[model samples]
Target: MAGDRGAVRRARDWTRDWGRIWGGAWHRGDGTILAALLAAWVLGVSVWPLARLFLEALAPGADGVPLGLMAEVLEARSTGRAFRNTLAASAGSVVIATVLGTVLAFATGLLRLRGRVAMTFLILSPLLIPSQTMALAWIELSGSNSPVLRPLGLAPPPGTTNPIYSGGGIALLMGIEHMPLVFIALRAALATLPADLVEAARIAGAGRLRILTRIILPLALPSALAGAILAFAAAVGNFGVPALLGIPGRFPMLTTLIYQRLNGFGPSVAGQVAVLALILVALALGALGLRALVLSRLSVPLGRGAALRPLDPGRARLPLEAAIWAVLAVIAILPMLALVATALSPALGVALSASTATTANFHEVLANPTIRRAFANSLLLSALAALVCTLVALPFAWLKVSARAPLIRLLDWLVDGPWVVPGTVVALAMILAFLPPLPLVGSLYGTFAILLLAYLARFLPLVLRPVVAGAEALEPAQDEAARIVGAGPLRRILFVLAPALLPAAMAGALILMMTAVNELTLSALLWSSGNETLGVMVFALQYEGNSTAAAATSVLSLLMVLALALALDAMRRWLPPGTLPWRD
Candidate 1:
């Protein structure tokens, strides 16, 4: 029902955008109208699907009660179990993330250490790797078939269930994945910590421990709490970690439950899944509200001043750096080594060596036409997503930061709606919204178009955020100078405005492409038979017991991501501040 309304509304938006932009944007000397139209398009991407999902969830259906369906869903044993599992896993992971992230933040952010930049990037590796790929790496690291661990006799015995399928393993990996959020937030908060305050504490007979307890932790607690809550929210929404681990391990989560129900029963279960999605939304919202309340109460906003100088560890410096590196290697480096070893092995449980290793897995991954097609599809879709997002974000971000267009600015907040929600929820919304036939176009379900649209909606904010910051940083005089010379909207944007924001736009687009290329959760649900993404293929191969091939494919995708990240780092000297997350 709501799908039809959404389709008509989209048609209207298309008409408006085409009629206003190409027909008149060049004729007029102003860009505001063009910006608004683009912003409207961005806004529509979020609204239609979400609206459809809500309507599907709220409709009386066969029953006449409004809230009865929700109650029924909430009361189901599986639903209750999923909620409890989600909270327990999230709670456990948040504790892990807080401890690791806060420790890393202080060690890297406050201490003077050799090779800090490299160590910091290594520490943040979990964020760069996709959740599914990370799950695979950990599985390979811990499973009975692990080449790396089997050599050391540390692996669980064969015929024993792999321990990684347990709830504890899910929490451990998720914690590592989200640790960077807390690290970044706490570091940012610590950046504002006044050196004078620390210096005074030091001068007043305060030791390092006393100063840390009295001064640093107090000021940094609010941001750490905020980051922890963000981590908790993220854990609740995570699908890949639990899907890969939880399903085989028999640990049910809301994300896995939704996927299983929808995948098994199709869109007929969307209403029921929508109820689960609402639970996820509620958990995320509750986290946000808790953060705001905590910040309001506990936050001690301090004046900006000279940052505290890096503390010297003196006699402990070498040991401190070595310990940090060791921990990072165990968490970030060893699992990947295990994954690569598995990829190179001839078969499962085979140890890797120059004499024993074979390239058969790589050959299968690369030479298989279907697998090749999946790779091509992923690359093409990601490139398109990046290109389209970059084009749309330029105009929308300009108006968004300009402060002159209140309406556009108001609608801009909707961008985060699609981004922050669970990937499963967004994919479900896409299914519900486009499964039905439209006025001119037919049903988008099982088509390539839906995947592309989902990528756009999911990633536009990633591109727009940096561009908005770049736009905000621009001097109005530069734009005004061009306008004074009678330059048209297109001319000013192409010639004067775009050049200034190119670095930011490119960085965002690159990151967006990297993210979309190896995405598993959305593609897992949205992919059709011929349109398998790399993520779906790897997941399928692993599920089908082709572990070697899955590892090979995952390695290829991870290499692409790493290569792009390195390229971005190489180019970051020319980009704006905050473009690279790991940069000092």
Candidate 2:
């Protein structure tokens, strides 16, 4: 009887709310508009630039170049070597990042390791600073007269060899810089492993090492591999690290090669850079596809009950914990101390005199007009991109939840597809999409707008994921109840849904802003003539050979991001008691 009454009421409700059905249809039409805009932004920022670059590379030369000239150039000795070096670096970085991150995650998550919280924070510290800073720090530390180690007999006396300029050094720095991301992902994966399975393994008399080898590795492999592959992608597209470390040794990766071409400013070479960028993008996609396939097979359903059980390490836990903390501290603090020394030093050549270690670098940077302009531009650009991304992501998330349109259903996939596309390729696509006769928009090429558009395309997924989480937490019945109490759609949304999802939106914005502020690859390729950000300035200052000033600038940027992250964290924690949907 209750089922029959519910069916009858639902039918009557549908009849009475025919206007809503039509309104949903209208909303579907609106979704098409959304799709069109999103498609334009994605194509402009991801596809067109790549196409233009390829076309320019393949175009006939002034003397009627042969059809296969571009291919021949790609096959040339230097290009072949660059490709090989890039692949080798990427593969090495991936292995190191994954292994280190997974081991750290295991020590902290499953084992009863002490100082886990502090160690985790330390491990993630590298993400707060730019890779260029880390490179410079390593470079300074490896110098013969480095201030910190000179008295300890660790610094090479005067003419001793340094590891900082080797490909091995580049790989180590890139791996350490990217390890934090894998740590975060795999740590979560480890923390969320099924307690029941772990307990069953323990009950079966499995030794600690055996359990870790057979159980944890298989279970955590998917996310660990994902993080590792992403690290590879980052390492492959990384220009700053290679420029600082590899270029001096004449070891050219794909990223360094592209930057070299861009600096050369030749049409043919720039087109070849674009071609390389496209190839990198394809590689990124293939890796992600492979990861997705593996993850699908090993996908474990997550829920509240899937939380980890602390695996007791008997009497050996304290020593293990101490070792973990010690390693994490070295990983985090050594580079930072090196950075401080670099910034304090009189010049690139570290003189260990107290007089040389003055605040002049900071003062000079503060007084310089270019530094001031770059700082201001970074703050403005980050703020604008954060706002635009958060706002755009909200409607997209809403459509994903409430609308049944095919476009809405596929919105998340579209937003996330760019993660597999290299930033260089994305920048090139934007340039190609708006070359000429696009009139007003075309003129804005090489402007701040292009950078912002590229950021939106690149990071919308980061913004949308948290938003979708917040949106999903909101029950549709809340909107229905508000309508029952005489509220309209706009009123219910403004008063009910918006407030419910505000925290997620803010979280998304903050994370995206963090990325925008420190983003190197795309911004390196696309930052305009006059609209330089701190990141661009850091790289430029370093390349122009002002290591002290570059280190000072990097320190300033790191402080800003740290403060922002702390403030956002506090905001999330102090939300009004019941305002957040998750709280209820």
- The best candidate in terms of lDDT: 1
How does each model score on lDDT?
0.87, 0.72
Clashing pairs for model 1 are none
lDDT of 2: 0.72
Query: Which parts of model 2 have CA positions greater than 4 angstroms off?
Result: 1-70, 159-161, 266-270, 299-306, 347-356, 480-493, 574-584
Candidate 1 residue lDDT tens string, 1-584 = 89999999999999999987766765555555676677668656777897788777776746778777787898899999999999999999999999999999999888899999898888778888989899999999999988878889999999999888889999998999999999989988877788999999878989999999989998999999999999998999998899899999999999999999988999888889999998998898899789889889999878778988889989989999998998899889999999999999999866778998988899988998889999999999999999998988777766566435666677677788888888888899999988999779999999999999899898888898988889988998887788778777767778877999999999998999888899987898899999999989988898999989999999999999999899899999978877776886
TM-score of decoy 2: 0.86
Best candidate per TM-score, number?
A: 1
Q: Count the backbone clashes (under 3 Å) in each candidate.
A: 0, 3
Model 1: residues >4 Å from true position, as ranges?
A: 1-32
**Tens-digit lDDT track for model 2 on 266-302?**
3335556666676676678777777778678776765
